[model samples]
Target chain A: MAAPPHFTGSLGYPPSSPSPRSHLHCLSPCNRAIKVSMSQNQSYWTCVTQKIEDQLKQLIPVRPPLLVYEPMHHLVFTARRTMAPALCVATCELVGGQQPISPNQALVVASALHLVQAALFTHEQLPLTDRPIPSNPETLTHHHAFAAGVELLTGDGILSFVYELLGRSDDPAGGNSERLLRVIIEIARAMGSEGMVDGQYRKMLCSVLGSEELCDVGWVDHVCEKKEGRLYACGAACGAILGGGSEEEIEKLRNYGLYVGKIHGLMLYYHNNRTGGEEKGFTDLVERCTSLALKELEGFNQGMVQTLSSLVRASFWDKC
Target chain B: MAAPPHFTGSLGYPPSSPSPRSHLHCLSPCNRAIKVSMSQNQSYWTCVTQKIEDQLKQLIPVRPPLLVYEPMHHLVFTARRTMAPALCVATCELVGGQQPISPNQALVVASALHLVQAALFTHEQLPLTDRPIPSNPETLTHHHAFAAGVELLTGDGILSFVYELLGRSDDPAGGNSERLLRVIIEIARAMGSEGMVDGQYRKMLCSVLGSEELCDVGWVDHVCEKKEGRLYACGAACGAILGGGSEEEIEKLRNYGLYVGKIHGLMLYYHNNRTGGEEKGFTDLVERCTSLALKELEGFNQGMVQTLSSLVRASFWDKC
Candidate 1:
């Protein structure tokens, strides 16, 4: 199946909200996507997404073990919004990287990010015994037999693929191996216990404890950092590393990613819980994340990072 | 809980078997452990196991996210029999390495191997939803709430840790990063779609298909190669890489690992299906694998590889 319509990089516009852009104060990403003539960055985003798609297809071919590979393919192709890869490439360009848009280090790391995300989604969707995810045939068409087993192993397989991709080096003598290793470590920690996995565990814990209140504003925000923030945070940081940014620049980008990640994560939380759209502190959270994200780019060349800045602020709907 | 009584690195003795050592003419690994006096290699094995245990603890500490970390810890600590790490260290020693047994490249790779195995076991044990593995409280003590979610996420978390561990470079300048990269790539492939995951898919397919005949001797042997063989093959090959072995030696060690892995996999299969003791082609397969594993060491110094040879041959109940 194709991507869910919302996954078109469009921040959800909650129906009950008085103003669609009240919280974010920028044009919706989906809307920006449509008015390509309005902003050149729209086309840039499109190109970056296409690059990611081509690289992903080349990296994960349709081989044997159709059971695992097909799910991995579908989940990645569908779940990917061009968000992570675009951020990676856009950051690379910002740092004046050579071959910034090519199938280079930035693109490879972004692909691995998507794969890790696919693995996370697979594990999260594990169903009850009798009720398989296949029951929602619309979501997972053709994933009938051994749905649980296939998904479980598919998640594990994709993770292995992530390391495999990262372990590769352009220089046979491994001149770039150390850089790649740093990326691997950073991404691993983000996705490992302290970051995404911990967030997931907390989220799951809330459900098991049967207390929505347990996911208080602060608690949910922390979860958001792990689940969504870390990926974006790592994506940006990894991009900076590939672009050969200085230590401070890498740190600044990572912080920037964390803020963007929070905004995206809160958006997800709001999307999932539509009824809770007008809940307290929700808008405040988004506003805080957006301003902080914008502040991080202050240290960089303003002209070089215009696209990245607009991408995070979700302002290409008009500003560009 | 401690490891199941079976994980003591002992080859299972079929009750119906005419002779305990009739098929392989060698002593069992478990028996070797008991009679440590007979073989000096037994002491080496103990030291290796202790090292793996210490590294695992250091790598996976019990801090926050106890839900995921706990399961990861339990699985690694309980399930690890020191077989994979032992093979790695033994190969490193055989290849004439300095600091071979210390916490060098070989040990790091071995630690990752055990972590990956823990992940595999976590995914493999996803229970029928209503009946959580916690129902077998003895097996998973104090793991009552959100058992499925915990296990699923725990599996993903551990896989991330594997990359995290592999990504670490002891040499600040990454002098050995190239070799580590090779080891990472090799292990990833061994556990990727065409290897362990595919084997699992086929094995699960047999059950989902509900055909005993589907898992024929040949099919099972192939399955064994993917599930068990690939891990050992990668383990030995990785050890050779860290030990600075020649390409030819690494290749041979990999083949040796393949043979040893198949033997171990078949033994697991036999143990799981105790009643299948009198089944067809079991003994012949073990005998064949034993001979093949031993032959791989012929090109090296006999004295140097005496421990490595006995490891695969399962001799030294008397031979040592």
Candidate 2:
């Protein structure tokens, strides 16, 4: 039996070939036709290929075939592929030594770990930025911390460690380690003085701590300037570290981080403003942050930046 | 403040002291009076002490000032002081990982692996001694393949591999490999040609593929001989493996395994005991498997073995 001919032009059948049986027959030509067409219409085939290639240009390119033959690339790819599996095998051996765990227990632990990662990733993109740095200091700190948390949670060191542990513990009992680590982290984050609740507390504290009568205005400004600016920088640092970003990538991340942070802060401030707190300066700060997050978010293509924006929105409870 | 005077006799209270503040004080006084009376009457206190001391002469005496150093007599006492904290830590970690897990996705791929283990363990306990080994050599080959399959599925090697993977992937993505491995194994066990369904198919094939005249005699013996024996052994192996039993523990596990296998095989036979052309032994095999599972399960201490037994029961229909 002969192979079918390759379609040379548009995939669409010619309008004149309307019969169903004819269309099927046309679509599945002989192998001889396929071979003949390949040899005879090389240029035409190349043009068609180029057009399709153009459509898919944005997608990550397959590594060059020659690269697969290169020791460095081959080694790296193989290493990367095996790292998680190897780790998992080791973990299982360890667990097997300690005690056997039921398969069900293993499943539960694995699923739980995945959920934690998803949650942490979702939380990373909270604080939004706007026009870049050189903005109000207060907004910067909030953004930076949020980004830092994400980096700590998802960095290669941590992610790889987790993969290694899961891979090693073929026994469900082995999942206990991963489960414990996640729980401890979540509990620490939730309960820490600087965590979500504490963050809220700090915002309220800033109002009183920065007041003219109770605080030295210069001291308050100095603290905000130092802390807030550092936070903004931290946000960029976190993005670069976790996303395997370059310096330029870090700068872009920083901009996005700051924008998201400001927006998040502003949303909080705006919501708080509506509820009885009447500080005009705080209101202005809130407005500035919101504008910045939106503007920065708009700079990137919607599809490319959707994860970042969605993360930002989720951080501010916009999705809630 | 000066240390309270050491109590004398049994009461350890001054005679002139007002009645003790509580019921304990009253008992002390009575005890002391009795001790004094005995001492004076027949020097009975000394005699009683001697006897008591003699009875416990081989045991180390508790040092009066160091209650903390005393060895705990009860298992619960030791457990409370030692294992409780460890168990608490383990449970806390496990629950914490599970907190982020949505209820819907809680049943993960790892669970399927566990089900396979449980089923295999239950099937390994069949009472092979009760039935005669098939005289026809071909029947023996089928039995051996069935046993090998059980062994492969429930073996330590596979369990260890799973544990290793779970240990490595503490992060969200860590669980994927484990889940994938489990899903593959379960799909193989439940749906593959050599799996549970296939086991039934082979049994039926044995009856029809051979001479029609000898079908009833050969099929009856085959079904009866193969009755849930393997399942019992499988279940026992599952429990022992998970329980951290060593090679030395195999005899006990084998005992339990045979019991469970017999019950499981019987259940499978009963379920597919239909007649004529539609007599594909699937239903009967399933029924026999279940019966054997329940029977072998009964040999175990229900309280201690509940975890594995419940898993085996659930796996039959839990859909992994």
Instruction: Provide i-RMS per model in Å.
Output: 2.8, 23.4
Question: Per-residue lDDT of B15-133 in model 2, one digit per residue for the tens?
Answer: 34333122122124434556544422122213222322232222223443222112211111111011111111111122222233211121222222232233323222211222234
lDDT per residue as tens, model 1, A89-206: 6676566566423237788888888888877866776664523333222235433234677777777888888888888744654367777888889889989888898898887676
Worst 10 residues of 2 chain B by lDDT: B75-84
Docking class of 2: incorrect
Report the lDDT tens digits of candidate 2 across residue range A1-320.
11112111332223342222111111133323453344212222232223222322321134443321122122212221101111111122212212334222222222323322322222222221211232233334433322221222122122222223333334454444333333223222222222222333233344435454543333333333222322332333332322233445445555554444444433433333332433454445544544554565454434334323332333322311
In angstroms, how far off is A183's CA in candidate 2? 25
Write candidate 1's Cα lDDT for B288-318 as tens digits: 8878888888888655465565565553121
Off by over 4 Å in 2: A1-6, A9-320, B1-195, B206-236, B247-255, B267-320
Deviation of model 1 at A217, angstroms:
2.9
Every model's Cα RMSD, please? 8.4, 27.2
| TM-score of candidate 1 on Cα atoms, chains taken together | 0.82
Global local distance difference test of model 1: 0.68
Report, to 2 decimal places, the DockQ of model 1: 0.43
lDDT of each: 0.68, 0.30
Each prediction's DockQ against the real complex: 0.43, 0.02
